[model samples]
Target: MNQYQRTHETMAAYERLHLAAAEERGGETLAAAWASVVRQWRVVLAAAGVGLVVALVFLAVTPPQYSARALVLIDPKNDFSVRATRAPTDSNTDSANIESQVEILRSDRIVRKVIEAENLVDHPAFRPGVLSQVLSTLKFWDRETPAKTELARMEATTRALQKQVTAKRLGLTYVVELTATMPDPVEAARVVNAYAHAYMDGQLQFREELASRTSKALQERTEELKKQAQNAERAVEELKFSGSLQGENSASARVALKNLESTAQTYRVIHDKFLERYAETLQQQYFTVPDAQIVSAGFPPLNKSYPKTLIVLATALFLSAALGSLLALLLDRRFGGARLKRDHFA
Candidate 1:
């Protein structure tokens, strides 16, 4: 036989061998795949057992967290003071205002007040625990700096408290939800309640400060106007008396008196307006209107919020099964293919 015929025979033999191999493997039947999985059931169970143990260990070690929530209503319409002064023109303005209030609820000023009120600075949740401090000292081989300043410690506590608290606006509504999470349910509730009160107090303080300043300015301006009005009235009287004493009531003298009287009247009008404003500002200084009202107060949670055992175990089981199945299939393909190649070559 020539070289070309020999090459053709070789190609035909390879095709036959491929066909025989496919037939021997039953052309990838479902039964065979299931059998392959069944044969590797031990591997699957072992992986699942390992995953379950790890999950249990995590559940044992991880601390449980509790969440407390406070609801606040930011109703501009209900605020008689603000409504009397200015009304929002559109819904967009109202939405923006609500969002601004949400940010304010999460502000450092509010968070810091919550921390200080709850005395959370020394809390292990917010600061390092005794064990952790000892470990850190050992790791640093006693070369660590003395300690953070009081201001730095307070700032750190504030940041930690801020991380555990969240403020969210409830969908197009005038309500905001303040949430705080902590290991202790009572502490969580206290922190959230403190946040609401702090925000309310802060708003009142801001308004009182503004009103006090305005009252002072108005009082000073009214005094100055009163003096000017008095001076103008005296000038008019002096001019009238001088004209009468001289018996010289001329057109020019009359014009001068009329002008002075008009100036005095203008000052009186201005002084009266300032007095009214001053009274209003004084009232506002004592005003007790709240910018936000607590719709729902936070209470100690009945159940822990973290380390959901069932969910963790379920997720571990699912992932372990998937991983085991993939490994089993890969091993079967590798060893089975190698055996087939050896058989075919022999």
Candidate 2:
């Protein structure tokens, strides 16, 4: 036989040896196991009682957490956006667009903005959460950086905040929900509200930046157009003053004057159009609005959302029963009230 086969057979022999010992003490049948458990019911109850006491102690020590949620509606087809962008949306594009907005809500940019605006780095809820504390207690991390440099502390705080915050879309709808869970219900609600406001603020800031860039570009273009118009007008004026009618070159001079006049008129018209657009851009800045709006504000939760009493108690009871049953079965096999005959094995 191969080495693997031999190893498997050896393990199989060991299991059979243990099973034979079990059968030697009592029969290896479901009814036999159930009878053994029934016989040792007192021990099982005592073990379960002890487990209940321990569970009570654990529940007393566990901290409570509360979650608060806020809702935001994303309208991608806002008035400030380009006409082409506001066109009828395709299903694939709309779905992708909503998904992208969800990611933006989770993005570091939006998170950091909220963090800074709400001063979350200095907030009481800014520590690594319960799971991280448990892992740290188990020595899963070598060096903790939250207590290190200022930048490191900020980064650590950001990570902690990110963990506490959850951003997701509700079904396929355009409404996005942002949730924050904290030991303090008020703080949790505040954080969720801050996130919603920050997202809308970010959109407003983006539009302002876009408008600023456009204004600067238009100003530059308007100046260039004005310069061209001036040059064309200057050329036409020079041609008129050059005595075109008295010269043998009057025919050619008139033609050149006509062309220059045409050029000046064209430049003036283009420059006027740009001036009008620049004025419109400035006006639109005043009427600018965010594409996203807070549909529902977060409120402090009335009850703690974590370390539920019934769940903890039920879980402890279930585990205790299972463990007690296993122990009782083993004890019965060790020293049974009734033993089975092993004449067949012999």
Candidate 3:
């Protein structure tokens, strides 16, 4: 080999050696860091154990709540695009209300109907508990009549029910999700179903009332028009007969006869129109359309909706360990090294 080639080979060997030493040094640093992490595991474990105990206590003490859901379809049928608009939203009828279907479901009127039908006012679930009794006594120390007390109880129960029950339209769909949360899952299901049924009943009742009122009004108007038409026809016949008796074939007589005939014709046309409308009202009343229907009825939930135990415990443990590691690091900075281990034992 030439002098220059030998020198280059020697330099390359020294570079390889330098790279090897650097890699070994980096590996040692990584091992030391891992060991340090392993040493702090005791802190993490201690914190995690404390967190687990706290979670366990919370699970034991906290009362579980049950939730039941019911799906009510706002427009169950294709009635909206059809004559249902006239049946329900009939502006001509004053008895029918123009309230939105979803709003009607959530209204206090419908809710109160359910409460009354189910006799919730007398139920212990609706009645005031110990806390409520204490507050009521504190506020109203004076004696109150049983009647007044009953009224107050009813009002309180309604307000409480309003809070427990919720109705919301699901996105752009016609479905409305009605949910009720109560201590008793069965009661929750019953109440939710009750509310749905109440809303539907109200809609049916409203349609009936509207149809009845409209039909009655139309009948009255039609009878009056019929009488007027008959009277007009009778007058025209009398006029023609009187003209025939007098044998008056003059231009004025013909003109008078023509006017009488026109009046009778006008009355007859109006009577026919009213008669048609009355028939339609009767038909609509018989085949009344419902504003909403219970698409999916609520049932008692199998699992408690509140206080998810497993998730809570896992989250608690993870957070505690993370915080513990941070605290360990701080101690390593504060009292650092062998002293931190000594302090941990102490």
lDDT tens digits, residues 171-254, model 3?
A: 666678989887789988999999888888998888788888988998999999999999999988888777543555656777
Candidate 3's C-alpha runs over 4 A off are 1-40, 76-99, 122-131, 141-143, 244-249, 283-287, 337-346
- Model 2 is weakest, by summed lDDT over 10 consecutive residues, at 337-346
Give the local distance difference test score of model 1: 0.84
Q: Candidate 1 or 2, higher TM-score?
A: 1
Tens-digit per-residue lDDT, 1-346, candidate 2: 9999999999999999998988776664777878878999987897889889888998899878899999999877664734323578777787788899899889889888888888878576677668966865797455656556467657877888889899999998889999999988998899899989888888888887776777777789999999999999999999899898467988898999999999999999999988877776676677678778998999999988888888888888889988898999999987763344454345
lDDT values, one for every candidate = 0.84, 0.84, 0.80
State residue 60's C-alpha deviation in candidate 1, in Å: 1.8
Please provide the root mean square deviation of candidate 2 (C-alpha atoms, Å): 9.2
lDDT of 2: 0.84
| Per-residue lDDT of candidate 1, residues 1-346 (tens digit) | 9999999999999999989988877856656666677777887788888888888899899999999999999965544333335755688888888998898988999988877777888688888667856765686543434364466678778888888999999888999999999999998999899999999988788777777787798899999999999999999889877854354557777787889999999999999988987887788777757677899999999988887778999998899887887777777778778999999999
Tell me the TM-score of each prediction against the true structure.
0.79, 0.72, 0.73
Q: After superposition, how far is residue 139 of candidate 3 from its true place, in Å?
A: 1.6
Q: Model 1 misses residue 234 by how many Å?
A: 2.2
Off by over 4 Å in 2: 1-29, 79-89, 128-148, 230-269, 341-346
